[model samples]
Target: MMKIFGKVAAIVAGSALVATAAFAEDRKSYPAPKDHPLSEIISGYEFRTPETRALQDDDFENPAYILLDLGAELWSTADGAAGKSCASCHGDAAESMKGIGASFPKWSKERNKAITVEQQINICREEQMQADTWKWTKDPNMLGMTIFVKNQSRGMPIVLDNSPEMETVRKLGEEVYYTRYGQLDMSCANCHEDYYGNYIRADMLSQGQINGFPTYRLKWNGVGSTHRRFKGCMKNIRANPFKPQGEEFTALEAYMMYRAVGLPIETPSVRN
Candidate 1:
């Protein structure tokens, strides 16, 4: 991912160099050195304090485990107009959902669109269970159910499909991440991509990888989905945010996940 970041920085640096040609000796903010040390690790977890890491490693101590339990119960709870449980169609999530999370933000040929795992859960809820779609941030179960399913793929490397449509979606994601918005004139790339190791006041900025979500945040005292996090980021940036789980955010989520291609799955994780 740093290689990609390096490429982006080089372009920006080159442009600046051209604009200030006369200040050849005084030009500043060169592209990140090719050998930036932090580039080697993708997940922000590697950057967390040891105490934070320990919080995630211990399942019993992890606040997210509480949500995971909630997810498990809802998996078998009858719901919707049809009053069917998830177990009705898909038995034992451990068996049925192995590596499922690692393969999502994918093109669902049946649905004819790309979907996150959260969306897949809603599809099953609406189609098979005849239920209403879960609201992104409002529905607590949405995050938990996603965490329960994603935990099955723990430690697995993320893998995405290489279909043509997916390639197009990836481009859209790239556009969104790089496009500056809000009064600050910042893009996702500006903070996470360009200055990942930098700090903002008391908060340490991270690469903002999603392998950890539906993660337990000490801030929220809860597990939340990527879209929830995205909503927060948007609000902070002063951008008019898209609806969570909406198509635009889904595209951005897919791109972010793709950027984290080789990272291990660490759902139910703890982060600052």
Candidate 2:
């Protein structure tokens, strides 16, 4: 598997090096909300090659489905001291989880802060299942379960909380998005907002939207969450990344979702 992955990586890197001289011109435009910063919104999907998009469109071809299937199994398999499964409480996820993913990073009244689906999964495991929490980016079970739940909301437009509390969170995220960080002194906006569609070494910078996470990236050779992507970008800029599931990332997730207001949920989306 490592050999295969290394070969794929080398080929992708080689192609990227060849394409470095050209700016991407394949971005699809969508009308932004009245109050949005940009006049248009673009999904990261548009930045990928047609082959990758085709993989995302075909359930059988998309490698992410392997993990999604695991999530489906985990949903029914009982676990922890309580001997309860997610299916035990939620019943049929098709019915119970529908549209839930599109409205996540929601204000948690009990926690008194915005919480992500990843965090909520751990909360359920600890409080209800009496099971240990899965590591944010390291656990395949967490990534699988997250994508499974999100897949239920595929094609639904993203709709986020607009309460004053959520508004504050969104504002903080926006601040983080625009703030320069690390040795390179680059901000998220420098690539995603300003140079989107332009080549950055071997990759085209997209809008950096989070609507399609936990996405399947060819570079990772597997599925991963939005926070994983966050950590990667931070490292690329030579900054110390905040911990996954921490306040900063949660706030950023909330804000990015807000930016994706009308975009359809594309869970298990395939990306370069």
Alpha carbon deviation, residue 206, candidate 1 (Å): 1.6
- As a whole number from 0 to 100, the lDDT of residue 93 in candidate 1 is 89
- Looking at model 1, residue 7 earns an lDDT score of 100
Top-scoring candidate (lDDT): 2
Which lDDT tens digits does candidate 2 get at residues 1-272?
99999999999999996776343444666789887877688888988888989999999999999999999999998899999999999999999999989999999999999999988889999999998888999599999999999999999989978889999999999999989999999999888888887779988788898888999999998889999999999999999999898999999989999888888899989998
The pairs that clash in candidate 1 are none
User: How many steric clashes does model 2 contain?
Assistant: 0
lDDT of 2 at 85: 93
lDDT tens digits by residue: candidate 1, 192-242: 877765567777677788888888888886677888888888888999888
Cand. 1 Cα-lDDT: 0.81
